[model samples]
Target chain A: MGRLLERLDKVDRRVIYILMAASVIVPLALKLDFPIPIGSGPSMDLYMAIDTLPPGSTVIISFDYDPSTKAELQPMAVALTRHLFGHGVRVIGMAMWPQGASLGQQAMAQAADSLGAEQYEDWVNLGYTVGAGVSLLRMGSSIEAVYPQDRDGVPYDSIPLMRDVRRLGDVDLAISLSAGDPGIHSWVMMAKDTYGVPVGGGCTAVSAPEFYTYLGTGQLVGLLGGLRGAADYETILRERIPGAPGGLATPGMAAQSISHLVIMGFIVIGNVAFIAGRSKRKGGAK
Target chain B: MTMEIVGIWLGALLTLALYSFLYRDNPFYKFTEHLFVGMSAGYWVIYNIYNVLIPNLWDRLVGTGDAAPDMMMIIPAVLGLFMLARLVPKGAGLSRISLAMIVGTGAGLSLVTTFRTNCLSQVEGTIIALTGAGTGQFLSNLILVVGVVCGLVYFFFSKPHRGVIGGAANTGITVLMVAFGASFGYTVMARISLLIGQVQFLLFEWLPTIPIFRGLTG
Candidate 1:
């Protein structure tokens, strides 16, 4: 028993890695999916914030993440755009991260298409703004000043969507889907605090807890933290918009939950082996 | 073969090569590592030149017919040139001016914004009324207040902790441990999600090319 516990303590790392891979791949291959329960958490708050906006109201979405976090944050972008466009809300899209510019355009385009909305009329891409928070501050006073032209070099005056959104203050709500800096924090500081605009958004799960204080402070009206948060937001969107299809976030969340349990089990077993080995050593000493 | 099929095979091979590090560092892993680093560097250089330089710097310096050239743009143009001086031995000192300007501006902006968003606003949020809040909200707020206050106390090292102060400090440590544990769990979840995404790509996307896994997934 003593030798066995010791061997378990120093189990081959490859075995653990293989098990971890199985935990993820098996659930995915089997099409294992868990239903998302509706709850009044941050994701719900974000949904309510957008849902409450009247039709024809405009919203600004800051795509502050790049390809690195697409797996985690893109679902939020697609779902949010879907919700907004489905409900007839105009969207002014922009990116603080250069890589996000194209992704933002794709999300907006897909959402608009699904809802049968026309481009440049229902939505416009402002492209990647260079000055970070400074650009956001400029947006508060005049969106036209910050982005004289759209991503395609079309002047703001020509885009029908830009007609109503002359400044950040004019928008009903601002949501930032961010992976790192110049993201939600920048939005809160430059847009919300400076212009008194309400802010909500999603971020990677790692940064979620750091933003909880902001959520509590009401600086961020709501937040969707990581893949779980994206799944939660999808749950609410499906409830509100009947027959909405499940996106990448839901399957990602299902796999993640299963892997988390597997990891937790590993932790418990590792600890038990450690305790058992220590007791055996003490007994030998006696 | 279709380009899509070729691309999938290439991606699967590269993914396997990268995952080879799990066993031990091998030639394949090193090759992928170097290729990735080289590609990323090249990609970012082109990305920045097209995204930032052409539109921001070049356009401003040599404006089109709709916008007149501003001679003032020469200042940034020169400063930007100075930034490249670091590659030369003697002219390296000249890079300090541009670097200083960048650092100074970044620091000044971050200081005010961080203070307002992270400090002042957070303080204002904690001082909410206990009366109007529902029982659940009140309890939540109470925990917040206690957690924040005790967490702050844990970091207060000005005086020696003893008696009542010691107890509060200990409680603060407990709160911090809970916060750390939660943060760690979040980090694990995030990493696991990324892993799951890759696995999904392999099993569903890459494996579908083979007949066996195609039906298995479908």
Candidate 2:
């Protein structure tokens, strides 16, 4: 015990970092899997939110995330889009992040292609915009004000999916996959509150807890929290959306669980060393 | 053969390079970090300028190569330009124009929506099922409301406290600490999950695939 404590006390930060990195990498490489005891509230809410939407309903998936977020947020975005398409939902894709326009369009395009969805008829891309939160407010008043045209520079009226959608009120659901300030909170304040449209979100794990308050307030019907939420969402998708090729969620959960164990391990070691050092000093004093 | 596998392989390598920084501050991590930042920023700027600024605002200004643009684009362009004026020493006053435009637009939205979303909805949520006030949710809410009130009171250190006020204040601290610990646990889980995600990509995506990577391992 004394020897283990002594080693733990002097263990270099580099060693700790290496262990953490391995903790993360090994599970991913070996495909280490773990049990996912679903937290019912957010997971169930997310499942119900998309499932309840009327088939062929023109649902909007706001890919408010960027590449920085693709890891955590993308699976949910893809899963939900798949779910929407599987149920024959007419979907329009858009992004708040400037880079997100292409990323969103690309993600939707890939999913659409994979799912036998045709563009313009099945879906369209509203693409990126400036002004962020303010732009969302403008969307509440008039989506056409901020986005007069789709990504192709054709007017919103020209796109079949966009034809009747002049404001957020025209949409059945507004789902924003967000990472930061200009993401979910922006939509909640702008489109949902102003236009009275139903809204839900998927945010990065760091930002997820702050939004439980919103869920409680009913400002958001559901929130997909970070990667775990994404993984959970994928499970819902595979079950709900028939013939959806799945990899993301199960593999993702494997990674998440391993990392948690790694961190817990380090924290335990750190505490033990601290206690041991204190005891050693006390013995010397005696 | 699969683009999916290719994407995963590259992601795994990048994850390794990034996580390697935990060992020491080295050129590898810095190189990867800078590369990621640069690529992300470049991708963002190009998409925004082309998709957002040019088509939405500029096409309306410079004409769509057919008819002259209407006067509507002028105000926004000018407002955008005024934002740049802050860089000029003598024209620092122009920043106020940009500030006001942004602030006015933001404040206008915030005023209406904050009330609708935060205040009104939160108030409504706090009120339990009036049909069945004896439920568990109602009891939980009663405890919460007390916690919220007493917690707020604890922060009000204007005057000295004695008796019930002080005792309640102490109880509020205990409540806050417990809540904080739960929140901390959740956050710790979330972060560790991120670490896990990166590693997962490295192992499953990169190691078994990618010719050069596979050869090196073999």
Cα lDDT tens digits for candidate 1, B11-127? 889889999999999999999889989987898788778777777677767886578887888998899999999999999998999999989987887788889889998999888
TM-scores of the candidates in the order shown: 0.95, 0.89
Q: What is the TM-score of chain A in candidate 2?
A: 0.94
Best by lDDT: 1
Candidate 1 structure quality by residue, lDDT tens digits, A170-282: 99999999998989989999888888999998999899999998988889999999889988988887777788988878887667878899899989989989999889889
Mind giving the per-residue lDDT tens digits that candidate 2 earns over A11-128?
A: 8888777776676666666656776665567877977987888887878778887766677777787778777887788888888877677677867887898879888888988887
TM-score of chain B of 1: 0.94
lDDT of candidate 2?
A: 0.77
**Interface RMSD, all models, one decimal each?**
1.2, 2.6
Give lDDT: candidate 1, residue A65: 88
